[model samples]
Target: MSTAAPKTPKLPVTVDKPTPYNFDLGLLLANDPNPVSVPRTTTASSDPSILESHLANVARDGAQVLINQLLTTCAITSTSSGVLLSLPHAQTPLPREKPVPAPKPETKWSAFAKRRGIKPKTREQRRNLQYDEATGEFGRKWGYQGANKAGQDDAIIEVKFNSKKEAERKEGTTVRGDKRREIREKVKRNERRMRKNQRHSEGRK
Candidate 1:
């Protein structure tokens, strides 16, 4: 048996037509069946006075539009009675008041507490604390008045200072330095993994 190759079909070609163009001067001179001459009367638009009046009206309208925009921008309004009212009054500048000094304990025991470097447990607790000017004292409004004591409630807290050896012993008994270092290393590894993942995601984008 003989093997034969199939023939490929030819594609049709496309041809573009040339554009037509024509010009005539006679079209410009052709007169209309009902021709109207340019106005010459005083009241006509072509009249110098009338033209000037139209221009003035346009200028006035433009000025009124600009004025309205200006009024709107300034937060102002004009009523039907011509009385101007501010839509939203301009904000008044805040007064530059004197700076109030921070509250400090005045009494002897409270002063000792201050010397011992006692600090508030929380920001809210510090603010809510009341000061007695007459007796030179401070008081707490609510909760364990024990810590800040005399400042708000005259309740006092006893805090003991630990020696360096005592602190080290306590740290060893609870959270050891080696354990803390291990935790820190683990956290750093997790952070590195997250950074690597983030970089991969960014590269994909």
Candidate 2:
């Protein structure tokens, strides 16, 4: 018996008409005020091809809407128009500004006067006097009146005023032997008064 040649089955032609993109950006933008609120979930059985196509459609629709708005607002006639438009992929919120530090409280002479119970004298008023207004003490201001040693060689110069003899030896050009003794005595008196004042302030505190 003669057998007919086996016929091959012809494959079904799938004429895929381009899938129409039906996404509307205005509908989504109007319904959802916050883009962050949009759901980004996908079903377990969802086809990747369909999902990809849908996302592409959504992007195209959103881009078209943005282009239309920009063109209308900017009055751009063509791509060659002077307006150069750009859009950022994502926007980051600005960081909260650091709280401005409170201004430091000013130190005023009134506060000093209140603490010492006396009106504070200006530097010019107390220039030539050894006076403590709080203690009502007056004495001679003792110190060497030598020329400033800025121009002298500092390595060779020695300044010592621990005693009358040392003061006379160090700055003999400014103070003589008797003057050096007076200065030494004045310094000791000032130191004793300073210690007493410090103790009184501590007690007050």
Q: Top model by TM-score, which number?
A: 2
Whole-model lDDT per candidate: 0.48, 0.48
Off by over 4 Å in 1: 1-46, 75-205
RMSD in angstroms between candidate 2 and the native structure over all alpha carbons:
20.6
Q: Give one digit per residue, the lDDT tens place, for model 1 in 1-205.
A: 9878888865223212142212111221111232223446767654677667655654454444444444445444567888653433334434668766766425444455679998646876557667767657865543465232223322453334775544666433432244445556878998876666555545542
**Candidate 1 clash pair list:** 138-150, 138-151, 138-152, 139-151, 139-152, 139-153, 140-152, 140-153, 149-155, 150-154
Per-prediction TM-score: 0.17, 0.23
lDDT of 1 at 88: 34
* Per-residue lDDT value at 183 in model 1: 54
lDDT of 2: 0.48
